[model samples]
Target: MPGRVFLTTPVAEIAARFGLDPEPVANEPPRQNISPGQTVVALTPEGLQHMRWGMIPVGRVNARGRPVMETIVNARSETVFDKSAFAGTGRAVLPVDGWYEWTGERRRKIAWRIRSAEPGLLFFAAITDTWTAPGGQVVPQIATVTCEPNADVRPVHHRMAVIIKAEDVPIWLNGSEERAAQLMNPWPDGRLVVEAATGVDWSDT
Candidate 1:
């Protein structure tokens, strides 16, 4: 699984490639370290916008009607569509330069950066929602959807984010649930480049 993600591409370039309006993120700066709870740029049917990377399950419940209280950073594709806990959630695609995963023991762990060899962006399928705080503040949240790892990712992790093709972005955002469900799978093998990630500050950023 990807423990973290990073985006170094410029916002305007990202907008041009994805056909999203650049106004909302025209001034967004390049970020090499993106973690959960931070704001991320996502593409939805409405357009590109910023949303918190973690989802706080407010009143959502499971199939048995039990409350789901965990703050989700990622949702498994296996249950995302049919899960009652995710009912009525909006869809989105999170564009990023790459993601990081780790291996080995806790203190001796190794970090690996995984990105597409094709070089533009990796679009991760995501679910979106909005949480209303007790004080009346609204926070838009999102969580990446994951599936069984592809060959490129299996060596480092057993799960990987659902990477959507550029042409399929619209389908993911506006297609029927069945069609969108079809897009939640691993990227093709050999398209990704994984290398040792160094110089990162694990404590922050």
Candidate 2:
């Protein structure tokens, strides 16, 4: 579900690599572990910005018409477009050095760090939404898109984040919905390296 990730690369380096202008707000430190509800960097139409990890849909409301906070951290790529909350608004990417996943029996689980073997830095296809509170405050939130796990990731989990290639950044950010949907597939096997992570806590690292 891509619940935890780490970003050791400087934000400027990631922005430069993707040609993202204006730069991301330097509001976060180099994190070895980040969980849901925390702020994270994302490349959006407003350039680079810090957004809450779990997306709160735009139209969530209570009986009194007050905004409700919903934590949606992962969107399945297969049906992202079909979901009203994600359709048409699912655009963005989260850059990270790697992500953590666990395997083995419930009591003997082991954490594994998975990352690209070549570039090391990878981008997770994501979606964002701007929700307004009754107090007139606007908050931007994001959720990662997930796809069927590849051979390397299947043993650890049934799903994995949709990893976008560097060359397809433009298409993912501004391409047609059909085109974007085409790119929402599992990353090819062998491009990723998975290893046991030592001395790292998935909750807070």
Candidate 3:
């Protein structure tokens, strides 16, 4: 699944692409290594905004009725709709220039950058939720959805983020669950270009 995301594009541009008002542009700097727990740029039914990249499953439970203790960065497309653990979650779209995947052994892992072959952005289908902390601090969070990888990404990873098309972004954000599920398929073969991530530092900044 997508562990890291890169969005070097300006937030204003992203807002414009989704037909959102770019006024009072948010100060989202060029980020090449957005990890879990960090805020990510996303398009919700309301509008474009930033949402935390992981969902803390506080009161949620699994199929077996056990409490889910881990933070969820990506949810499997197959069970996302049916899982009780995901009940009451809203939907959103996380736009990005690309994402990073890793391969190889534990000590000698290789990093690969995957992006759309075309000259534009890619949108990942996502789920959203709100968590109220101890002091009533409300935090909005999100988790990308994942499916089997396409031909281009299969060689490097077994699964890839569920990338919805630019035209289908509205459906992913506002459509019914059944309708959204229809858009969870992988990107078309050869539509993605994966290359070895070089030079750029992977340090947790």
By lDDT, who's the top model here?
3
In the range 1-205, model 2's lDDT, one tens digit per residue, is 6879988888877777767663456655788888888988888755789988987665654445666466689989977887555544648888899899988889998889998888768989998887687899888889999999999888889999999987887788888889999999999999888999887755573
- Residue 167 in candidate 3 has what lDDT? 93
Candidates' TM-scores? 0.96, 0.88, 0.96
For 129-185, candidate 3 gives per-residue lDDT tens digits of 999889999988999999999999999999999999889988888889899999989
Give candidate 2 misplaced runs (Cα > 4 Å): 58-70, 202-205
Segments in model 1 whose C-alpha atoms lie over 4 Å from true places: none
- In order, what lDDT does every prediction score? 0.89, 0.82, 0.90
Residue range 1-205, candidate 1, lDDT tens digits: 5568988888788778767689987777888788998999888778878999999998999999999999989999999999999999999999999999998999999899999998689899999999998999999999999999999999999999999998998899889999998888888899999999988777766
Clashing pairs in 1: none
